[model samples]
Target: MSRSPTFVRALGYLALALFLGMAVVLRFVIGPDVSFTPQAEIGRYSDADLVALGAELRETGQAGLYKFILLGVDFVFITVFGLWVMLVHAIRGLGPVRWVGVALACAFMALDYGEDLMLAIRMGLATKGNLDPAVLTNPVSLVHYVTLAKFAVFALCMLSVYFVSRRRA
Candidate 1:
């Protein structure tokens, strides 16, 4: 292989390693257990029930932290992936359909990143327990799934590079 091809492959693998490594760190070290919790509107019940309900409500705050952590992973993964795709294209040609997949992946990753940033800010505010009623009602579930999907997409991109390099095209 040419020096450029070899270099590109090295960078791609490095990026993938960084992406997955960070993901693992987030899942275990960062705060996964603290982040995935439920947040229902429990204030509607009697004030006497507020103690038990309050505890449940607090669990949802962990969900917010969960998303904040995921946002960190998603942002790093997509930004690196965007570069990785362009690198693969330069090193080995791919059809327009494959290019479209890269483009779509970038778009999905971008959305995931933006949503995470927004949630992180809101979560910081929520930590102070000053969050608005409407904000509290908003669940972190959506962001959670989207962030996980972002990682999955990045993994697909990494695997595609190997296939692309091996193919005749």
Candidate 2:
């Protein structure tokens, strides 16, 4: 709230960079040969897709590694995004509505972490060849919905920042 516009802008840029970088790193750690598509962006995949992905990860022997790498990425992701929401609040000149962006960002972080943990558990089970379709159903659905809500709230926050900034300009 007390931050200058220029400082807020700098934080926003840094957050954007970290967010993209972590995403790219996570993708690479998951391996190029793996055919698994991330459900974070596209929502949940079909049961067959999950099975195929689990098989690929299991065969490639990278599921555990992926879990570790994703955990690190998720950490950076949430930190950077939390900064972004703060930057948004500053850029919006610190109002009650501006705090809504902060609230949404917190929600996004919680959901993001939950999704990461769920995926890690799924990967662990899959690597042990103990994962069942029935087990995949609930967590997968919950993660997808959480991801959708996270994105929706994030988009709203971004829009609020944009409109508010434009108005000030």
Candidate 3:
């Protein structure tokens, strides 16, 4: 069964609010001006770069907190938000097949959250002063591949929105 239009819209708005709030926290609170912002291009990070990131996380006490925020909150919320974006069109009469976007959103979330978890594990090791580059090869490679897939899916989802709008217009 499908969800109500009002409920879906509310979820979408709530996701937006969470996103905005997190952006504020990332930019103003646990930010570059104080703590080194975590790298967005994590897939490109070398072993040394990961070590440096760990050191930054350790130095700024962001290792633990950011892990929770990124994996637990941001990842989940953004996935749900993307679902709402993709589904709203279908609910409004685009077609039921558009629900496939929901599946794609979940895949994006898995890739993103998996990447974050790998980094978080490294950060935890860094906090303990036990980070070893030799152990990072697999996770780093996985993160790189996942990041690529995640972005590709996300781009497709966004395009669906654009096309849907243009078709409606």
lDDT of 3 by residue, 83-115 (tens): 776566565435554666666666666766776
**After best superposition, candidate 3 residue 47: deviation in angstroms?**
3.7
Tens digit of per-residue lDDT, candidate 2, span 61-167: 87666655567766775777777776666566456766776776787778777766655555554245356767556535555666677677778767776665665
Ranking of models by lDDT = 2, 3, 1
Measure candidate 1: CA RMSD: 7.5
Question: Tens-digit lDDT track for model 1 on 15-74?
Answer: 678667755655564434342221212122322232222343346444434454445555
Clash totals, every prediction: 1, 0, 0
Query: Where does model 2 exceed 4 Å of error?
Result: 1-7, 26-31, 46-55, 125-133, 137-140
Candidate 2 has what TM-score?
A: 0.73
CA deviation > 4 Å runs, candidate 1: 1-4, 32-74, 125-132, 148-152, 155-159
- Tell me model 1's lDDT, rounded to 2 decimals: 0.52
The per-model lDDT (C-alpha) reads 0.52, 0.64, 0.62
Residue 139 local lDDT, model 3: 40
TM-score: which is higher, 1 or 3? 3
